[model samples]
Target: MTLLLLLDDPAQPGVVELQSLTDDGLPEGSVSVAADDLASAVREREADRPRWVWDDTSRRYPPLLAAGVRVERCHDLRLCHAILRRSVYSQSSTLAGAPPGPWDGPREPPPVEGSLFDDVGPSVVADPLAELREQLAAVAGADEPGRLRLLLAAESTGALIAAEMQRDGMPWSVETHDALLVSLLGERPRSGRPPKLEALADEVRAALGQPSLNLDSQPDLLRGLRAAGCDVESTRTWEIKALEHPVRDPLLAYKKLSRLLSANGWAWMEAWVHDGRFRPDYVPGGVVTGRWATSGGGALQLPASIRAAVRADPGWKLVVADAAQLEPRVLAAMSGDTAMAAAGRKADLYQGVVDAGIVETRSEAKYAMLGAIYGATTGPSAVLMPRLTRAYPHAVALVEAGARAGERGDVVSTWLGRTSPRPDAAWQAEHAAASAEGAGADDVRAARRRGRDWGRFTRNFIVQGTAAEWALCWMASLRRRLLELDGRPHLVFFLHDEVMVHAPAEVADEVAVAMRSSAVEAGRLLFGATPVEFALNVAVVDSYDQAK
Candidate 1:
């Protein structure tokens, strides 16, 4: 029997009211109980393994997880509604046909200290049970309800993982982080800049022959560089490196130190790191391609130098697993390209292409394949594009079709169903203006530029979005597999194509096996009976720095 958890204030004043929902979202089986004691109610229901239907997983699951309660399944209405409404498969559904409502509002951040996942007022719902009915109708109306339902399930599971990872923060080491900073940029001084940064600034000033020039200021530095006749277009690292002047070295050093100081400096350490762990605000489905983005602390962009701080607790080990050549394998599976699938069987997909004699070197194969997917029209990649097309026609043609559709301003859906948004009004207007009679040269050029950009975005979107779906399934499967064990291994961190589990030393091997097994399961679930293999490189270490 499934339990429908309605978070309402009036339904049972200051408590959760549990109701039994029928397939059509009607009240059924008159055993409705007001769960004043939420954890116990949840614990009892968890043992029954009922699918808890709720509004938001991020809002509801954290408290249960924190209270040592776990559930087998959930139906996150908000997340499912979002997926269903935008999916091309559900275009004929009522939810997709109607105007956006409160459910469309930006998700509230998970409560920090307030009533944890508490019920909302009557006005907030606007009849939530009916809303669930509408969402179910949408799922039923989808062209491929099975795939869309699978997507929603995977997305909701991701929400649960995101919240749990936040609660159980990633293992971090302040001592090691501080030491790395000291080694690279010197000790944290009482005031002003670090010693290495200060020394670099001094060298830069001497080289520029301006003892007091403000290197921190971009305009002032550009003027100083111009005065010294150092051929620099901008303060970009690539631009600076091309210079032959002595300022290049110190300026590079200054930029590196500046980035470090600004992004992950002492202030950052104090703010982000707490109790030997870094808990980041993870926003799942934040990116258009379904990739997870972080709210703060640069969780998605942790620098390699700062990774020394990600140490496991004593007697614990970090099992890091990253999907190897994820996008290429996704392409092979989706395109049903046996040649491409065979090439991706090796650890290095590009090298395999080189061995197949499709390209001269691994680099050529890499650039060509990436360029094809990304809509490159010129340069090294474009030059090698024909060879790759001849070698792997289907994989190349798949992206080419996506690119063509994007150029025509048509929306394209991913493997499961997340659809690319149609061109906005402004974009359509601009494109129309370019098509109008007697359009200016500048207008035509601007329209062409926009076309290329959107084409590139759409070209990459399919593969990236499918890869994200695969990742969601991978992590969800791993979560279930890990939970099946005696609750020892815990997932502490997750990036796009990687996951790090904090487990006991004795279970490290088991975690590695689970990671690989989960990959196989995810692949099978997405593309059954396909020849493509979603390979992963697994590493077990005491610190995150040890993993690639």
Candidate 2:
């Protein structure tokens, strides 16, 4: 009744049969052990049975026994079967020097066993219930929570979702709304001359208090108007006027135009909300810097039409707040540029840099300072680099150090654990070769490129990642407070710098308090009790634009 087993290496195609044992006489219980441990167990069993004789010539053996000579029914039947099967196969393969046959390789291991009895012996295991309970407790006790908020104008939810899906690499299509007011209006070409859509424009412009209303000069100006009241035609007119404004900068202008043409575009977006609640598609990992993405509707790119559509639920008011020059302020704090930090603390950092005699003009200061931090070498950076080096020597040096580190192929981490991936060896080698060439036209160009790339990486890794962390904390706090409040106001939207909550008209003040508290808590969590502050504007309206 001796049985033989064969085993093989899949990669090598080599087989081995290493041992033999009896079938019914094999170890008796259901317990199993790894094949490697079989030899030790057999030897241990033999130590207790010194008088028992084993025949080397025949491939058969007697039953195993412990030292007491009591027939040890303690034999693990499954373990013995597997071990013998593997050993026989391994030995057979070694003898054959070929791949194992169909019945050759090691058999799958037996299922694990456990017992209900607690005091059965040392073999009994403890239940995982206690461990699970501890895990639940830890989860409850952890103060930090991670979640995302997406604030989109009720009308732009579709575009936001589409954009978010695009960012997430998800395939999606935009829905066309033929009956939407924008489509109907846009389809009819304004008479031989463009209509005095300026009145509608004037109303919206006056509402937002923006001076630029020359439709020829400000195309897409309608995108800026808020939908304060529910006059649908007026809302459509405001959006169209904004969209029609001529953009002086071609690139910026194109973006404005594209936003209008995309299906579920700015115009159609005005109709997709349920009771004025626009739920934009939120792609959590949309931005490379951990910012959220909106899909179908340009949720992130709030058009005037959509903004006008954001209305406070009856009895509630919309409270809007935004970080002033958030990135620059963050950069100042992170780089420990005391001067820069002080400037940010007082007024706009860019303007402060200009006043400090860093550059001759505001534009120069902005470009050079931003370029210095962001590794901008072309266009704006090219014009501003020298000014930045002269004005803020220490700030320039800090970013330069980061750039140097990046050029050497080091991965940089933010103040938090978030890290940037290391540059490939190819990039490093190219940079080194460029550096070795020494200041020729090509060499200078290469050097600038390398420096700029590195600076850009370092700049964003710190500012953007930290900003994302701050945002996550803020959202978490707001969520918690919302849960605590009695009136169940729903969080309808979250944009990078803003949040929109839909609440009853009566609880508008309460919601505003909650929003402000969340921002303050977020600031404290990230920067400690610093003097960082935010300004908010609140309004009640039937449309998004009216709230502003």
**Per-model C-alpha lDDT, please?**
0.85, 0.44
Tens-digit per-residue lDDT, 1-548, candidate 2? 32222121122222212233333223222223333333344455444432111111001111111111111112221212211222212223221233433223222221122211111222111321222222223222322211111111111122222222222221111222222324323442333211223334444455545556443333344344323232223333334344433322322333344344443443354444433345444544355455666544555776554354455544655555455566666565556666766656544666767677666677776777667657776897777787666655666776677776765666554433344556666676666777674546786577567656775786566566666666655665675586667676645566676666656667767877887788777777666655444333444344455555
Candidate 1, position 98, lDDT: 88
Per-residue C-alpha lDDT of model 1 across residues 88-158, encoded as one tens digit per residue: 99999888988988888777666543344454333245466777888889888789988998898899888
TM-score of 2: 0.50
In model 1, where do residues sit more than 4 Å from their true spots?
1-3, 11-13, 29-36, 118-124
Q: Highest lDDT: which candidate?
A: 1
**Number of the top-ranking candidate, with TM-score as the measure:** 1
TM-score between candidate 1 and the true structure = 0.95
**How far does residue 392 in candidate 1 sit from its true spot (Å)?**
0.9
| CA lDDT, candidate 1, residue 264 | 92
Q: Tell how far residue 456 is off in model 2, in angstroms.
A: 2.0
RMSD (Å) of each candidate, 1 decimal:
2.0, 21.8
